[model samples]
Target: MLSTSTVVITSFRNVLALSVLIRVGLILYSEWHDARSLVKYTDVDYRVFTDAAQFLLHPGPGSGNRAQGPLGEGYGDPYTRETYRYTPLLALVVSPNDWLHRSFGKYLFAGCDILNGILIYNILLPQQTRSKATLYTALHLLNPMVFSISTRGSSEAVLSSFVLLTLYAALRDRWTWAAVMLGVCVHWKIYPAIYGFACIAALAGGGRQIRMMTLLKARRILWFGVLSVSTFALLTGGCYLVWGDPFVYESYLYHLHRLDHRHNFSPYFYLTYLTYPSPTVGNFTASTSDASISISWLNDILESPLTSFVPQMTLAIGSGLVFGYHLPKTHLPFTWFIQTTLFVVFNKVCTSQYFLWYLLFLPLILPRVTMSTTKAVLCISVWVGVQALWLSEAYRLEFLGVNVFYRLWIRGLVYVVGNCWVLVQLMQGYDYSYVTRKYVESK
Candidate 1:
């Protein structure tokens, strides 16, 4: 007799098989290069590997002088020193691991995957009814992206998993506990904090104001704000107090000005339209030896809104309009999802890592929140495919030529359309919803 779990486990195996194939190619290529030929560890794992290096674990003239990374030192020393930039509070929760990094660093990094996977699976399980939770957890466990995060020990996984818990708590009407999770998750990654607005939207739904006089007159928002601020203050202050600034702790902060980066497939890709002729790759590469070529889209994404911030004001107004209209209708937890995707798509820099930021949310979107589970999976899988294709060497051929990367362009268009499909699914009113509907109907 086949149990329901068996069937879902089988499906998970299928996804796992596909994931193995997708990665086997990369592994084979790496193996194809021997010790003499291999350059250095690149790909998403490099960042996580390096992020760990940046912490107290690294012992070279720094915290413990242990020398960071399993094989090397610092995020960018042999590579480049890009700081791990999150608000101060984030460094606190994982401080235990930070301390444990010296002896257990390798294992600590390994355990990050274990911890996150366990949390995501169990947290989402009860939310899904009628045998869906098992399937959901199995799929998550098998997702190549999840495997990738675990392998590198990406801290984004830590933050994203926390966000899921926060959302789950809110859905359960455990609002205070939800606040605790939100405050903490935001402390780690500012991106998920956008969900707070979603929570507010949830509160403000359907022809009614969400004004609980206690929430306002009692200064509930103010108190929460203070609590959040204090928690961050303590964590960041304490960590830096011990480990102190490692090195080159600025790249993450510098991103606001790093418009010219070729990574991140944002709308900035269009900048090539106006600037390619001036310093074409042929000439640019001739003059500069290493890493000379860059997509022209950088200037446009970074250039607009330079004058007195009118552009930002307009953007805020437009965003306000979207929220104001949608707040009364669409579920709010997803509102930030729409905002993040739109900005990433239309803006200038859409890095591969950025995809994980949203991928973490799909489980919430699936089986009930918006699209059918199959469609939700498909929507996510398409973007993942686009990324996988882009990461292959074949992309570097045509991509490195025109600066436009024709294949990537075509893929981008597909992504835009797919993105719109989900946005509409989430933005429009209807119920394939589980938690969101419960949140509204309860009030």
Candidate 2:
């Protein structure tokens, strides 16, 4: 017969096991479901997949001008389907779509995500550290919102991996390598240029950047600047040799010039158009809440295609400078990176999967700090899930339905609450000189 103590411990163990299984199961479900959404046999996505596959093999790169639609009704659509905006150089990775089916590309992307997760944990871990960072990294991957990007074949995952590598190189004082890697990431998506600039600024802004390790001064500035500009130029120009027009090779840049429509994320544009539309079509009554009438002026501003992606450009520059200047070395880089991501998120016209670009860095950044294991994991997991919800709301509404929006908004609220909790914990740690016993014991 077992002792009473054994019974109590066994019962608690069972409860814990159940809770863990539920959590893991949810994460797996989230990943698989989001992935399956793109491959459903009876849907528009299947049609797109089928169309894209046919073009992948038959299309001749030698064709001078390609008609664009889905892209537009002009010389843009490369395949008579969607205007392919991605640089042809990236085709090395993306081009396999021509041989067989659309799912092939997506599966390759999924593999990249899993590999990325492993890379994150590997890089974040300290050989001789106080606590394991993998728990936190896994938490970040499981962030409630992150599922959207991981499973959808978004390029953000690849870009994010490059960014983390860039930052890691910089922290280790490998300036040249950092710039080269960052340039590659930026070419993937122009966003990483902001991060690269931040690294350069932190190295340059000697007065503001406290040197916990080395006192980097003006010399570092010149090297960083030269490397970034020169390497980026080389790759950008070189990419022309690989695909279409080097200049117009990337039609997406043109496509994104969305002076025509606006999402709520763009602060100035949306507020301006929502309150007083450009055509001055404000206060118009919708036939039904269900009937969607896109505010035309808002769409015009986004679709205008002028050199007017002002807020995004300005925010990228300002954030790179401001936070880069104020960034603390002892503070984990995740604190800084995550905050920058928030600025981008709140300030720009980001799509759903954009979070994957920054989220990948959390594993590397969080380990450098002194946070509890459970808290860290919870933060990242909810974050990934939240990203998934956000993506589903923006890009896959019919599949996830409106219910996912509730999850998206709730995840945001949870983030607010968690941040407050962190604030409280930080105060205790700084004021009293140690984290509370609750954090340590629970983890």
Best by the TM-score measure: 1
lDDT of each: 0.48, 0.48
Structural similarity to truth (TM-score) of each candidate: 0.64, 0.60
In terms of lDDT, the poorest run of 10 residues in model 2 is: 431-440
TM-score of 1: 0.64
Predicted candidate 1 versus true structure: per-residue lDDT over 244-311, tens digit per residue:
44321331234444444244454444344234444454313323332224333554543543421343
Across 53-87, the per-residue lDDT of candidate 2 in tens digits comes to 45543553544334332332223223334544554
Candidate 1 residue runs with Cα over 4 Å from true position = 3-110, 121-127, 172-177, 202-218, 236-252, 272-333, 369-394, 397-414, 426-443
Candidate 2 residue spans exceeding 4 A from truth: 1-57, 60-83, 100-102, 127-131, 141-148, 205-217, 241-252, 259-265, 268-316, 322-332, 335-339, 365-443
